[model samples]
Target: MSFQGEQHPGVQAPTADSEGFRLNHTMLRIKDPEKALAFYTRVFGMRVLRRLDFEEMQFSLYFLARPEPGERIPEETGERTVWTFSQRGVLELTHNWGTEEQQDFAYHDGNAEPQGFGHICFSVPDLEAAQAWFDANNVTFVKRADQGKMKDVVFVKDADGYWIEVVQADRLGQMGD
Candidate 1:
């Protein structure tokens, strides 16, 4: 009961070398490529950095990321491919062919019981504006900006019912100020 300082069981602390590694991307499986692509691009302002289609495997991979304002994805195939891989925090959406045809096909969103993955986050310049946009566009909100216990935070869902954490970048550094 009188534990002053201790290292937890089976726990390892990060070292300076860990800083050299960066998380490249996280993936989500989708049922329909068209539906997924439209939702991400229209609602989130993301672009298809690169897309790989596997006919034999009956699936496709689409790498999506929000490009900087006024930024254009290079026209050259090689340039765009390389540019896509270089960026960090990209979202990779996989679409298995024929999923939309099945009557009861669905991907586990990792939000139900025995949860493993919760959600992906996006930081915006203005939380209120983003929330308003979502509301105006009829985007599904798992947790609204005003309804949540935590103030100034929003959680919205995509076409596939995946939760996306939204925060205000300007207010980020000013949290609790």
Candidate 2:
């Protein structure tokens, strides 16, 4: 199962021991946990699955995920932490203690001259509706769905200037030339 013209010259087949392996989460460093948390939870519709604080290190980790319908989240700290780690597609936000207090502190968004990391994506049920919701919530847009060569895809920026690609899963098939 490969794309029509894509090549993977040096790729090897998966080994048996790696069968159960899956991506758990992607971490992003944020300055203000409050604003980041609000943007993620209110705008993206994600819920905080678990939060771990390290007083000695003066930092905290917040794990968030969009809960499925009828899904139950564990209440106990130990159990919730374990559950959060086990789930796939989780977003982890790391907040350093004093960065929030600094007036001119900012993290590299990886989209400038020395670009490295790219963007994270979220698949929505309805692309148009999602766009409307984003507009109503005052979310910043990098590109609108109709702006680029690619149609039916939107890119928005989060509170920390992270690009989030939004698309409808069913429409992805029609995106190819």
Query: Model 1 misses residue 118 by how many Å?
Result: 0.4
- The sequence of per-residue lDDT tens digits that candidate 1 reaches over residues 1-177 is 775455879867678888667777899999888888988898789888899899999889999998878877888888998888778889999988899788788877789878888999999888888888898878999887778567778999887888899998766565663
Reference-based lDDT, residue 152, model 2: 88
Clashing pairs in 2: none
Ten residues in sequence with the least summed lDDT for candidate 2:
2-11
**Residue 66 displacement (Å), model 2:** 0.6
| Per-prediction backbone clash count | 0, 0
lDDT of each: 0.85, 0.92
For model 2, residues 1-177, the per-residue Cα lDDT tens digits are: 855454479867678989889899999999999999999999989999988999999999999999899998888999889889889999999999989899999888888759988899999999999999999999999999889888888999999898999999898886655
In model 1, what lDDT does residue 10 have? 82
